[model samples]
Target: MMVRLGSSASRYVIATMAALALAACGGGGSSTPTPTPTPTPTPTSSTPVFTSPTTWSVDSGSSGVFYIATATGPAGKTLSFTITGGDDQSFFTVTSSGGLSFKSPPDFGNPQDANKDNVYVVQLTVTDGTTPVNQTVYVTVIKPDADVRVRRVGTGFNQPVYVYPVTDGSGRVYVVERTGRIKILDPKASNPAATTTLLDVSAEISTDGERGLLGFTLSPNFATDRTFYVFLTNASGAIEIRKYKTLASNNDQADTSTADVIMQIPHPRNAHYGGWIGFGADNYLYITTGDGGSPSDSDGNAQNKSSLLGKVLRIDPATDSFPNDANKDYAIPTGNPYATSGGAPEVIAYGFRNPKRASFEFATGLLIGDQGENSWEEADLLLPSDYGTAGTAPNFGWPILEGTHSFVGGDTTGLIPPILEYAHGTGGQQGSAIIGGYVYRGAVTSLQLNYYFGDAATGNVWSVPTQSIARGSTIKAENFRLRNGGFTPDVGTINNVVSFGQDNAANLYIVDADGDIFIVEKKPTA
Candidate 1:
């Protein structure tokens, strides 16, 4: 290795020796070859996410696990669910397996949510021991058919006969008592049973038979004029539709001193004084009167075209057609069937035995619940054609035909039959007295546009589809029972229903003659 040669040969020998030394030392030409860098491991899983629908619907009384939240997370990691934050988050709880449940059963009518709407909202969180993923979810509580029930909102009424809404946005209702007293009720009050007397006509009204303060309604212009009307049997046993004004000092109190008699009709008997009075869509006062009492309309008042008894009368209370007479202060509406010369100017439709209650379906339709004789009870729906001059006036075939079945005697020409007729009995759908109700235009979706009526004698409630109230059609009705919600202390079937009412919001009410005011609501339980 020390032998020397020429310069080029010496250089080659030196390089070779260096290369061999390097090889022996296990070294490369490049200064220590950089070690292959270990790559950062790729994520084994993605961020946790909700794999369930954000919106869900459950039956009103649903509790426990109605919905399940599914999520995907890291391998070998447990995905957990939780209600993080939201207006109604306190109403719900979640499990490690992602099962979402209600802490308490929900009621569609009385929502516990922050908004108090049936739609419930919550903030849902999902995590896998990492950064939490969040989502806003909504759950709706649905009202089932079995969930419709009546809950007592007011009590201690002295035989409440009718309930009228103030419609002044005050949420107050005027309850008319059979003893000639009107009281104001705040259903949401701390003590709903406590009431303030609005008016007392006990001294002026006769409470004989089906008399006394029978019906009450607010003037269409009540907000401004503060005028209201009452239907009562005066001490002399005459039907009187009187007008009164609310005290300017207090919206809840009426002027108890005096009332103006809008119209007064002499009746032969006390029992069949049709008492319901209301303003129609035409801004005219519509008065319902029964046939001069005796069984089978023995006096033939229902068939007589000139008699106002046994008829629905349309009159303009704002005008004075009978200026010379104080008993008939109102003017006949122009479109009244006999406004010109055909019949009694006030009579719009005749041949009703005793239309105890009637309400306008809208502006153009009138529904009358006429109590029957011994065979049948009936409800008649009168359209514009039946009351207006453009069409034949409705002749409900009272004495001549007792609800599509021939009974006594009358001219059979152009008779309008009852749209709904039921047998007279206290069993099943059969009922004795028919109490007319409004076409439900309330917040309850299932009851919308359905016509409701009740039986005072049988204590049964029934409803028929509005569309089924057509001529020449045989329609059936359904038993519409607003029962007690077994989950809580609730009022069961209202007995001796005197009337049905509607508030400004169109929420329907059932008036029990035994001193209770019930509101239609969702069954209060899960």
Candidate 2:
């Protein structure tokens, strides 16, 4: 601009000067504009996260070693779990690897507490690196669908074997101890404590195996007359069914003067007395008899229709005399199976090995349970319509057929089969014996309804949904068979699962051989 030269020449001179100035200022910094500062990006963190499920389900009659699946965090994470709250926490157990198991099945150890619902809350916590997470799972326990609750109500007796409960409309329960003593418990009372010595027949009753006061029942009109009956094996080894009148209302003992012999079945052997008595829906008393003790019906009395041994006898106690006066100690009902078959009039149903217990379902009038013998313990469901009817004979093949299978050197044809049959051994593991139970029909709960019956040897209470038990049906039995339905500690170990009886209100009562009585009621846990 100072030189004022021609346009092109002056422009060239100015450009040269500018280039020189940029080179002096570190390759065009001051003259071309200052360079902007470069910025650095910040890094993000790398931590893992975790989550877990919130609920689970336990099958009915499931116990011990409850395993659960969990959601874990990234590769190297750890988990810790605990049962935060529940009723019967002591009844459960947990493992380090997130496994939850019961010490015993819920209803096995202790009777479900009616006052509280059964519930369990399990909490699980997981950690990944420094990140932590937690989850809570809820578990609910329930009773088996069957209404019967077998429990050990009394203890401290020498070799206590059988227990029978006679209940009043009120919540009073009278239990018969095999030692020939009656114990009473007032369930309605504050403490529901047990009282002793209501009646003691230890002197007259035999305390040997399968003997003593094995059966007891209240008169159909027990409320008004306070009359009751007991079937006992005497010390002299005779089975007697005696009638008694209760002095104290709802008391279990006979008013000394009221000891009248209703009937007696001559028991030749110490074993196989077959002493169980109950009033049928027809109001006739039904008595069960054994095979006259020994194996293979050696006494010949079991197959003899004229004799009561190994037979179901129906009789009227209203007008019965002692000995055989054509019709004294007991009168045969016209509806007896052999009344017109040219056999003994008192024979209701024949071909039983040793019928230990018989119960009448209140709703459907069915006589069921307990056929004892060499290889099989059976449960039979007898229909009222099938009573004394031709073409309806129940064979219960004893010496001939052990269970459903025919054995060598025994009759195989024309034998009635059992509704439910099981082999017996120690605590019912191998082949031992069968203990029968009642058909539950109560108002308290609706878990196990319409099942045919319950078994004692296996400690497995089961049922068939059908109203009447048919031949060769898939009967469902329940127990804690952990691995492939094989052996387990819970097998055949149901304590106090002795006899099944009912009260005035039709509530089922379970008595233990330990002499304890437990009234079955619905105990729901959420």
Estimate the lDDT of model 2. Answer: 0.55
Where does candidate 1 have its weakest 10-residue lDDT segment? 1-10
lDDT of 2 at 303: 60
Residues 1-526 of candidate 1 have per-residue lDDT tens digits of 1111112211111111221343344446787777877999987557886777687766666444556676777788888878889888888888776667788878887889887778889988888888699988898776656655656889888889888887879777889998989998887787769888888899888887888898988889988998899999998888999999889898788886657898888887778888899998789898899997888898989888889899988889998988889888788777877777868888888899989788876566677898888888888866665565633477888989888888896578778777778766543355788888877776666666567788887566666666556664334332232221122226544657789887777778888888988877555567
- Per-residue lDDT of candidate 2, residues 311-395 (tens digit): 7777888665346552146666766766666567777666667777776654233444545565556666554444548424445
Model 1 misses residue 32 by how many Å?
A: 99
Full-model lDDT for every candidate: 0.76, 0.55
Give residue 497's lDDT in candidate 1 (0 to 100): 79
